[model samples]
Target: MASKRKTSALLAVGLVAGIVSPIAPLAVAQQLTTQSTAVTHTCELVKPWGLLGAKNQGTIVSPETVVVRYPATVAPGEVFTAYVQPGAAAMRTTDGRQAGLLSYDIAFPSNSTNLAANYNGGGSGYSIPGNGPALVDRVAANGQLATEGPFARISGGATAFHGANSRNGDAVDRWKAGMQVASNTTFRFPEVALKMRAPVSLANGSTITTALKAAGQSGDSDDPTRNTIQGAEEGGWGTERTNYYFCGSSANAGSLSTTTVNSSLPRYLAKTTTRMVTSDTLLPLAARTTNLTAEVSSTEELMSNIRPGGMNFTIRHKATGQLLATVPNVTVGANGQATASYTFPTLSNGSYRDEYEVTATYAGRVDDIESSTSEPVTVSVGYNEVNANVVLTSTNGALSGGTMPVTLRAAFALPAGKPAPAGLAIQLFRNDLPHGAPITIPTGTTTANYTFPTDTLTQAQETRTYRYRAEVVPVISGVDRFVGGSATPVAAIVVGSSPGSPLPEGGQGSVALEGFFRAPQLVWDWLTGSIGQAGAFSSGFAEN
Candidate 1:
């Protein structure tokens, strides 16, 4: 009983430091012969799961099988999920003694790129000869219980080196089985799975290998892995097999192949600069062409020389959040500069000012660079310019059928060679509200004229002056855009010579009227004065 107690004590002490070479001291080779009645043997059987097969069967486990599998090629910053598996166990005892899987230790390659981010242990498939049931056994890693329907999760997902072993920096598993093995003449062990994760760095070629340690330590005898199995080999002894089957000597034969990081896969950095080439908001019917300039460059050398048609520009309506167009395949020049343009449709909403937000994307070359998109930018589409004068064909300030003719001229600041538009129309407003029928600008002409009858103008009891403004309306099939001061109030008709309230919405998305929350006292300021002081409405209105 004293000798039996000593052997059991030593066994526990050895396996704790991670499975290694010669965990127990041979000097005290367990004087078991004097204490136990069971017979013993020095010969051993190498589990058939190993590659040596029958060649190593009769000998004390001389060949080991530790295999590794994972993706051989990985880019920088990619997470590598790798698997390390030790050989299955095949042990036998003529006297009805049992021995099988419990725990083992594994190590990762020592490299700067390998990180200890994730370590998971699990597996399935096993056959219990004594119990006659197909069972599943696995190492529970990172504080998880094994799914074997037992409490076998000893201590896995552990990274402590435990000792002076160079590979311990990534040690995982000091795990144990939940149930003791049942007596059997021969028992089959279960397959195990250990997974680890690390990110690849900026290396041209990095080697990722996982190695398994062995129990057959010391150069004194090859049969050391044998240990005269007196039933104590069932993990009763400190020197235990991962499967308690005398897991032979280990070799570094199974390791992952080299992983290569491509040059353009995840290497180069990129930037895209945007500039509004047209300078200001386009005037309605003023050649709906909105021009833009893009500077697309990369941090890598000679990237500016990339061929044309690699960039795309996306334009979206700010008011309605609708996709207008994607100008595809523009080319960047030697200076990392490119150009893009979009012809906008008429703004559909008359009350809201419309702007086109643009974003540029660089479709990098598959063989050399990666793709990227630029920050977004916006430019107002249209805010028309109107100059008006009133002409009366009847008595002045006439309330009856007197004809009031107003000549409307269309003009805009367009690029050279770009013609001022035709096919556009203007709508008149009587004091902030839409008033008359829309007038169209005939093709081949830049001017539109409309005369209104007197009865259309309504009056209140007090002597009042009616403020009138003509706004360019969307008559084309596409976008109709605008900004604050819907249309400058050009003329006023006096009924009794009394003026009304100050117009706050004159420069809508342009500025802050001049002071206090509402449109400032200078509500009638021209477009310049209108824009600078009213940044308050930029989100909904603005002028070039």
Candidate 2:
């Protein structure tokens, strides 16, 4: 009981450390002798120094098996032995009598020798029997009975190592029994050699995946169990066979890697929509907002498995290459898409030349290493310039049959949030053509002064309601930005008056007639005065 408990503890420790060896069953013919047991032992296979480069561990796909080849140079006929001694249990004979003795077993397959000798060795191959209860049996008059036998010769090249020893006949068993000896015997045992077998199959349709571990450990693989020394098997009490053990480094096998490939199709399709809120209350220069929406999807599947919360959007100024805004951690809707909105900076009431672009990138999750970026979507920002009429006035008075003085006043319509225009230039036209070169003027710089005067008009040529017009263009920092506008045409009458016959009146009649005639001259003077003051003209004629 105590011995079994100790072995159980060791087994538990091995399992906890991930050092699991194959568990082979005892030979079917090897049974207890219904008597007392004796000293027990254990043994393990060791890789010889010559085969240090051999493969010890690996993994394979289903249907394929793991085949651990032995050192090619090793041959048959060389006896392999395991010396046994009293472990947790004291030595006892088959007759239930305590015996101060030890047990031993030897194996020597005839495959190498017999195959060369007769071109066949049957099923007699090498194998380490599975661990079990003490092999001690009823004590014969000659010695303790043996419980393990050697491989038997049949009619094949070599037999596959079986879970149990062969049971051809008692002759082979007797020979195997004779091979066992007491610890005091003079028989010599060869150096331990690694024991391996044919490819091991897992199941009918099963795959095997071995997770390689970080190396540099002493007992990572099926490391040999050593109680006996390496060279000549010097000082050791017993041996423990490592059943169904793999014997090499897994690092030398292979490696795991991954490659990333980009596709022409975007992981998410993005579209941007932009518009200005043109309300009476809102400033003409109010900032415009743009909404960006991206549809997340996978070309491999009908419906995209991509969800929300792992995506971000970047809005950039396409013209200036500036980053406008960044929207992160956006959630996708049930329709497999996400949306974000950003408003551009407020600008003056005028068309803008700048445009914005948006792009979305997906952050990958578990089991899926593929990530995608949406193609850039563009949104143009613009505004309508407020058109203003140019006003035409006179320096002296409305044009008449004599020389007339004229001045042109132009008002620029700047957007709400835009900077003031740098300057202004005006052109007066008698009839749409450059009115005798452009009149010198300053515009945009300030709100106070934005006007120019034309040269005093010379004597009229054919006076037929002389028409006048003006054009005003805004200058921004030496650049002509807004389109110029034309003022409404105005006409001046150049009529002639005939002298009235001498008044045939006397006394008050003559005086009243003189006052009435003087009224026209006064009215003409008043019209000129009103023109100079920028007052509206009631009618084209002089009034009382």
Candidate 3:
């Protein structure tokens, strides 16, 4: 990885006075009377060639910038003081060997700026030769120099050196230097201040913002804004160049400072709204016999906020809070809205409430702001009893085997305390008895008299008899109870060679006939438990 190194200098009063005494004791002492200088240096590793393994080469092509500043003033030759402190190496490997060379580009902006020729009196002090160049060997490593650049430019009041290097064979690059100036001219000493900017590698981009938007949020200018700029690998150099410029401002200058980062714009996704449109209640005399319907409406505002392909709609029973049904990801129109309907059947009669919720998920984040739920819709159903009456309308009940003309009429009356039945079911029995083999009756507006065939009886039998009876069973809405009330009176007929003849007589005939009539009463008693006495005809019959 690429890295950055910084060095700061803090000088003691004793060292400052010692370095400036040789120029002219009185002049240096006067210039250094009350002056303080602070120097800061920053080194940044850079790769202009974009070559791989360049970082591991142990030869760092870093541009070092320095900012020099003086907190106090001094008279010429009065021991103008400055100091340099060495910095740590810029790179380290697994083996703990420090690697790389330090190269620097120093710019003074004008030639008027000056440094002492031999501040240390040519002993252990840095020297700038008048003909050749200022060169200082590395003290920490072994082969590093203080000044390596040949690019020299004089402008304004300073001279600019384009590059420099240190040759420390110990694999560690350390820059160590310091200076105290004594001016030859009779002038006041100016304070020296240094400011530097280093470019560090930010290979991976940074995160800026995260947000949520409610459903139906339009493309209004109020929407959040987001914008980003690619980082630079190599740009302008020098101590004054800012790092990570934003809108032309150097608000972010330091390396890897999270506090300086902020969002450029906001992002919103998946906006939606839901509501209950209609609800109704039903009351049937039987449990699990009622049907209910609920209508719901949904609308979406933003298109891109919607998940790719579709969205999901679900209905839940609020009372039990159980999910009734789930409709998976449905595609919406460009208008960003859609509507659907649902019906529930065979629902048990009781108080029930249900709610509907819609969700939209996109790009790994569920946009909950756009999600919505409908108000609870409650439905109550009560027991509703209605009378179903079947009447044998025809007086001629005698018949032959093939296509006998028989008419059975049926009608219904609304229950005493309930509304009219929405619909009815009618069944016909074979032996004119209740609860026997059934024949389905078709629904109709008015009382229907259906004509069909009756079972054929053998002519060889001495006694041929047929009976017809009709029942009026009460059917209640939203309830499971089947009520039997005022049935049509039983009708009987005796079939013999003569149309009108006295009832045929035989031994034990009266006993056998009574047993046959009592059979139906026994069956009705077992089904309903209404019959009380053995051979009781009136007990099973409806009173009304």
In candidate 1, what are the lDDT values of residues 239-300, reduced to their tens digit?
Answer: 22221222322232223223344323343222223333335444354566756666665432
- The local distance difference test score of model 2 is 0.31
lDDT (Cα atoms) of all candidates against the true structure:
0.36, 0.31, 0.27
Clashes of 1: 22
Candidates ranked by lDDT, best first?
1, 2, 3
How big is the positional error of residue 175 in model 3, measured in Å on the Cα after superposition? Answer: 85
Off by over 4 Å in 1: 1-64, 112-202, 214-248, 254-258, 267-544
Clashes of each: 22, 14, 47
| lDDT for each residue of candidate 2 in 1-544, tens digit (9 for 90 to 100) | 0111011100000112342233211212111111111212222223232233322211111111111111111111111111111112111123221111112111213121111101111111111133212222211111223222221111111111211231111121211211122222222221112121111221212221111111111221122211111111111111111111111212311111111111211121211222222122122224466456676664222122346335678778786789978888777666556766657665434544345677787654432223467777665555334334445554435444555555545454444444344345556666556665554343333232345655455432232234566665544332124434544455343221223212111111111334323545333533544223334332222211
Residue by residue across 467-489, what tens digits does model 3's lDDT show?
Answer: 44444343443542333322533
